[model samples]
Target: MKFLEENLLDHLQRPEFAELHSVLINHKFSKGSYICQPGMGSNQVFIVVSGRVRVYLGCEEKEFNLGILTKGDIYSTHTGTFVQALTDAVVLMTDVKTFRQRMVGDPEVTKAMVRVLGNILKTSFTIIDGLAFKDVNSRLVALLSNEARRHGMSLEDGSVQIQIDLSVEQIARLVGSTRQTVSMLLSDLVRAGLIERPERGKFLIPNLSALESVGGVTLS
Candidate 1:
């Protein structure tokens, strides 16, 4: 709680922002809580103060885990409920409509937010390009590469460990593949000593080079 304030309260110090932040509420979710569903009216922007969130979209009633959002990330009830905590989590919640209005009212906030919307646009393009041109394994590999670039931690082994652990089913959802396919790929990767599932549902990419088999990623 203190950390949340320390990190955010300063940046959100404007009188308008204070008013906006004040209206924001707090929510806690137990592990495995289904926080969002399709067709629900969403009105809040959520900032995780602790723990992590899974943001996703769905098709024909099947949900896709788009990405894992961690602390300091901001999300709103944009289309349906796009986010759900993966563990016991705390979030600072704000009314999205009101906040959007405020952004319209303040040029500073508006520009800052427009930048965000632009990024979403860019990601939508990425999704489109990926779906059309990439194979399931290639997509999964690229997604992991992106995740590692952002959230991976340096391990003593000179490889990086992505802290956001996920099951093959979750990975399957992200890559538009079935769990059976993900299981096969994962097993093959493990058997070849290219990756190690040192713990349940978690893979340690001890070296980035191992992911090269998935190929065509521009890692820099």
Candidate 2:
């Protein structure tokens, strides 16, 4: 059993989750895999150790992107979102039954609960703001700039390689927008000479400083 002995595990010392230290499952998944069906989550919490996963919500066989889980993150709240593997990944899984039982029986689980709840609330608020405040183009730009800012690797000729192979449609779902809007945003970026698409669905950032400035990350 892979143990969570890191800072997050300190929550187990709480009276709420002290007894939850046992009986959890660990597993791995390859790229293009489904971790759980949308709206069919069974109270399981997944801790991602490597790679990325996409969360989506659905109704009547239609699902949309909720968010992406990167390395060293956790996903427990269902909230109508089903977790899907975006890349080859590994995860630690524990269900809602163990969660409730552990919350009272294990101190660490209790503490972890508080942290996780705070994170969930924070993300919820951010999503609300993104939906209410930004236009579709701005939203897509912000999302791409943020993702590239974090995950991009600098190339030799001032270009940065971002590994995600997202088409405009995927990006539209990501920012809670439409494909036409995202296509316009991409076209704008392309015209500005800020992004280079050497291959279909792959975006290479040619100038980090300018992109960062537009991204509101002051180049310091």
Candidate 3:
């Protein structure tokens, strides 16, 4: 997934950024590996070079997913959250002290940090709104619509085709619903002509308007 057009390295955009390459130690983790845990001594931040990771709260039985970080996403190792690799992944790890030192007197660095924090806060709010007010179906639609807007291709016929490779359980976990419920809802969407499963995992959204309608979204 093209999660980033420009990353932290690009944000700096200076000759000094070349120094990051030397400091960035590449690390590989298998799926299900714990990257970090709450209260663990974490003194570094991570930049995902490839693969996916999930930052969440709670334990194994019930997890409230805060966000999913794919390629180019950043996460602090010191966060009071459990981070696990959702897929076999490679990440760039650098000392937090060094990273901050590099940014010590640069206004651009502060702006970049603000931008990243702003996005995180926005995502947190969206999650809160969905959980507090939206029903399961609406939440699922919003989830799919968000993903579609990010990674889907728009066709000449006004349809959007997105490659969703996540499993039913994974999708359920993301929307804070049961697997059975999400599966039934997905079937309903197929029958309603709003979505089509062209392959096992991929989806084609025939009409974005229909999706928005079902999701109870009104665009001005």
Clashing pairs in 1: none
Cα lDDT for residue 122, candidate 1: 57
Give the best candidate by TM-score: 3
C-alpha lDDT of all candidate models, in order: 0.65, 0.63, 0.76
In lDDT terms, how accurate is model 1? Answer: 0.65
lDDT of 2: 0.63
Ranking by TM-score: 3, 1, 2
lDDT of 3 by residue, 95-181 (tens): 899877665666755565565556657667787888899999998888778767766889999999976556788778878889999
- Residue-wise lDDT of candidate 2 within 1-220, one digit each (tens)? 0112244534434454445546446789998887887456466776676777876565554344445666545567465566677778887678877666655644544565455556446545655676798666656656666556655677888788776656667667767767897788788878898887788757888886686556454311
Which candidate order results from sorting by lDDT in descending order?
Answer: 3, 1, 2
Worst ten-residue run, lDDT, model 3? Answer: 1-10
Q: Candidate 1 lDDT, tens digit per residue, 15-85?
A: 76766667667888877674565667766676666777776677765555555656655656755645666
- Candidate 1 regions off by >4 Å? 1-10, 13-18, 100-112
At residue 206, give the lDDT of candidate 3.
Answer: 93
The total number of steric clashes, by the backbone 3 Å criterion, in model 3 comes to 0
Of models 1 and 2, which has the larger TM-score?
1
